[model samples]
Target: MAKQRKIIHVDMDAFFASVEQRDHPEYKGKPLIVGGQPNSRGVVAACSYEARKYGIHSAMPCSRAYRLCSHALFVPPRFDAYREVSNQIRDIFWRYATEVEPLSLDEAYLDVTYTEAFNGSATLIAQAIKREILQETRLTASAGVSYNKFLAKIASDMDKPNGLYVIRPEQGEAFVAALPVGKFHGIGPATETKMHNLGIHTGKNLREKSLTELTERFGKAGQYYYNIARAIDERPVRSQRIRKSLGKETTFAEDIHSIPELTAKLLDLAERVFESLSKQNLKARTITVKVKYADFQQVTRAHSTEHIIQLTDLKQIIPLLLEKTEAGIKPVRLVGLSMSGFDVPVLQTHQPQLDLALNDEF
Candidate 1:
């Protein structure tokens, strides 16, 4: 028999908003929206649990969130604070498991299959991690323990703030069978809509379809769907998932079609991207510039240097990169800059094809 891997998914509840509350006790026990101001054109990055009662959520427009809860406090994100907390949590995770895959600043999956901690019991390790987090950060986290990443992720979300849940191998199928298709982590709104149209509302409904039939409907993702429906996700908790690229972008409230204006935005984005790169201690040989026009059209251009890039080099290369696009002539709505072609030596490297989105800011 194959070895059953022990995995744990740990997620900080209301990460950004909770950090805000932790720093400012007055914000606690009240609806707090973190991202941008209500009058701004940006969206909510995250909101407190109290804010969720008002039907507010991350990615919703701050203005719309304001309309939903007029009295809610809107706060800008402090990425530095969140990043620090993330590092602290990561340190806590590393104490128990060596193989940890960070999904975001506030969530990660830990493979503790070979760990000597808690007698190799994933449940005990999760409990210890959560306790350490609360004691160290004064923050709460929810954890899910299972034999696989998919089940662990699902189990972690089964409970809310400061909760722990588990899914044994034997109970995996029954647990997934009763789950709503939309509740699956990888199934987004679009996929859920398609699944619902096909009468695949629950895992049970999904398992009823043949792999060929699903492939005919869902394309390549059909194979993934078929396997997950059987609670059989074979993907490992990969710790060394290398960084593909690093970039930053911003959307404007109004479009501009002037070269001078676009140039200014490009410089700002370059500076921001460079700052991020420096913070991560990364260097790149390639710099990419993305432009989005007011009509929802987008374009990108990239230039590679002979050696690792510097901020000064980026400044000169950005204007040249912009020349590859029609940004000045076309009303530009957003601009982004990214640095890839990392200097780190790896076993294998794959440069992702650039697909600049029409409406996406980054």
Candidate 2:
């Protein structure tokens, strides 16, 4: 039999806000928000725990956040400083485990199944990592230790701000059974509401449904839900995650009703996406354009070619693609461009042809 994996998920507490507060002493113990000005169209990127008291959170519009806490300090994100601190945290992870999968700048999963450190106790390894992070970066982190990534990730969130929680292999099922379905990591608000309507309110409730029933409702993701409901997740902690696609999008404070304005916005987005592609040294065979109308209806149009997409190609193609959408006819609130299908190289035999497809989702 294979040995059970020992995984630890570590998450920084209010990472961006904490970093801002640490650098600015006067900001400490105050409700601080990190993102755009409250008057801008931008949303909150992160907020201090103090600000969360007023129901402010990441991704809430800055205007709404301001309304929640009028006196809260709003500041822009310093990604350079955050990246420096993230590097420090990553360096610490590498010291103990060779298998570290970073989820973001502030969170990661470490597989310590084979490590001799702390006599191979995953709990002890987590404790040591938390201590080192606090000492080295002056930032507190929460850690969760379990036999699988799903439970480990969920366990880490059970406690907060310098917390350390562990879920032994035997306790996995019962722990999941008692937990709320909404608290499950992969189940977002929409899915949670759907599950609630289906009378699947907890892990036990979810477990009662047959695999076929779940698959019939949720499609491919149903298999994942079925497994996690029973405390069974077979996903390995992948050390290197591949980049599949690259894209950029922007939301406007005011809706755009002109094709020229929309085209200009898409060209700008295309430039930014191409710049990112250049930085990664990647070439794309597929280009997709996404538009969201003022009514919140979203649609995508895609064009795939055998040749690598170039700026000249996009300049000509973008305007044509916009004609397929209802952007100018209906006010457009957002526009985006993305490139994908990177695995294939350019073929010399076939001439580049525009393979347009409608009803694509981004």
Q: Could you give the C-alpha RMSD of every candidate to the true structure, in order shown?
A: 8.5, 9.3
* CA-RMSD of model 1: 8.5
In order, the Cα lDDT scores of the candidates are 0.87, 0.88
lDDT of 2 by residue, 1-362 (tens): 34567889999999999999999999999999999898887789999999999999998889999999999999999999999999999999988875788999999998777666777778888889999999999999999999899999999999997899998988999999999999998999999999999999999999999999999999999999999999998877777676677999998978899999898998999999989988878889899999988777899999999888898898889888999999779999788899998864443322112322211110
User: Best candidate per TM-score, number?
Assistant: 2
Segments in model 2 whose C-alpha atoms lie over 4 Å from true places: 295-297, 344-362
Distance from true position, residue 7, model 1, in Å?
Answer: 0.5
Model 1 gets an lDDT of 0.87
- Tell me each candidate's TM-score: 0.82, 0.91
Q: Report the C-alpha lDDT of model 1 over 230-264, residue by residue, as the tens digit.
A: 99988877777879799988988878888777888
Candidate 2 at residue 18, lDDT? 99
